[model samples]
Target: MRDNYREELDDIRGCLVDMANSVGSQLSKATTALLDADVTLADLVIAADDQLDATRESIEQRCFTLLARQAPVATELRTVITAMRIASDFERMGDLAEHVAKVARMRFPDSAVPQEVRPVFLEAGHVAESLVTKAGTVIAKQDVEAALELEEDDDAMDRLHRQLFREVLSEDWPHGVETAIDITLLGRYYERFADHAVSVARRVVYLVTGEHRINAAG
Candidate 1:
């Protein structure tokens, strides 16, 4: 019986890792399209999001099966609940990637962001990607410390988001109102992605330590 429970836990972890990889690839491709103005890559990001949706459903179904069949307790129950929570976060991340791809497709010949702001976008994307990847590691390794560190990494994305808005809204910036809106929206997408990643990390910390971390209340 113990061995059977262990097997189920392993299955849950495997499914989660697969889901994380799918969402991470979506984020990476979306970032590439935004940075290079690659319409093809944007299209690919849009198409790939469907796979993540399917993966989420598959994981959710497996979790439900385990709950019904095994009747998990304590840590096992927590693991299954965490799996569900993380899957939802990954799905939301995929949606945010699609939003970015939409912005890329919106401006065909020109990129949504100005050349000057490209670096900021790239940095935010990197931070957001790092957050997701790190959350995956925490899940696999059950590393509470690494999960805690995600909050600090999220700060960089927040700073860059603010910097992007400040520059776009500056009177001297020359791209006009339309350009400002695009960049503002793009920055927001990246920021929100990072925010969701942080949310996942907090759940990981809770699962490991059994104490909820401090975060903004809904």
Candidate 2:
């Protein structure tokens, strides 16, 4: 029974890693859909969100069951609890990707991103993807160092987000209010996606070290 419980815990950890990879893939496709104005691809990303939701539910149920049955303590308890929180972070990441896809669909055939700031969105996509990929590694290995590095990666996303605001708010900006709003929303989606990825990494760090890293605002 002890061996079986250990296997169950490992399985849950593996599921979290799989969920992280799925979120990364969704972001990649959403970025392509946004940049190219491909409604079909955008629709695919939007529709696939249901599967991510199901995965989150499955992870949560498994964690709850482990908690009720095995009564995990110390690091094992932290692992189970952190898995639930990380699952939630991954689900939110999926929603953010879906939001990006919806914007592409709304603007259909005309890229939501204008020519002047297309590069910013493109770079934001890259940073978001990189952060999630590293997050998966942190989950699988429980590497606190790699998890800490995600904080720096999140800073890159923050910089890109700020750059986007400057471009839209500049006096000489050409895009009108409607386009500016779309740009603002899209930048925020990417920025928040990176934030959640970092959040997942931080949870993993906590699971490994029992130390919580406070945000600047805290």
Candidate 3:
């Protein structure tokens, strides 16, 4: 029975890694859809959000069951609880990706990102993708050092987001208010996506080291 219980815990951890990977894939597709104005790809990303929701539910249920049945304590208890929180973060990340896709769909046949700031969105996409990928690695290995690196990776996303605002707010900006709104929204989506990824990593850091780093915005 002890061995079985341990296996169950390991399974839950594995599921977290899988969910992280799924979120990364969704963000990547949404970025492509946004940059290329591919409505078909955007629609696919929006539709696939349901599956991410289902995955989150399954992960939470398993965590709850373990808590109720095993009454895990100390590290084991932390593991179960952290899994639930990380799953929630993944769900939010997935939703942010969906939002990006929706914007692409709304401006179908024309890229939501204008030529002046297309590069900013593109770099933000790359940063977002890298953060999530490292997040998956952190979950899979519980490497506190790698988890720390995600914070640095998120800084890149923040920089890109700020750059985007500069482009929209420039005195000589050529885009209309509508396009500026789209750019603002898209930048926020990427920034928040990176935040969730960092949140997941911080959870892992706490799980491994028992050290909690508080985020002011969180």
Q: Write the per-residue lDDT of candidate 3 for residues 121-149, one digit (tens) a residue.
A: 88888899999999999999888888888
Q: What's the lDDT for all of these models? A: 0.84, 0.91, 0.90
> What TM value does model 2 have?
0.97
Candidate 2 stretches with Cα past 4 Å from truth are 214-218
Q: RMSD to the native, candidate 3?
A: 1.1
The clash numbers for all candidates, in the given order, read 0, 0, 0
Worst 10 residues of 1 by lDDT: 209-218
lDDT at residue 209 of model 3 (Cα atoms) = 83
RMSD of each: 1.5, 1.3, 1.1
TM-score for each candidate, following the candidate numbering: 0.95, 0.97, 0.97
TM-score result, candidate 1: 0.95
Clashing residue pairs, backbone N/CA/C < 3 A, model 1: none
Q: Highest lDDT, which number?
A: 2
Candidate 1 lDDT (Cα, whole model)? 0.84
Tens-digit lDDT track for model 1 on 1-218? Answer: 87987887788787777777777788888888988889999999999889888888988998898889889898889989888889998999999999999899889768888888888888888888888888888878888888888888888888898899888878789999999888888887888888878888788788888888737311
RMSD, candidate 1, Å: 1.5
Ranking by lDDT: 2, 3, 1
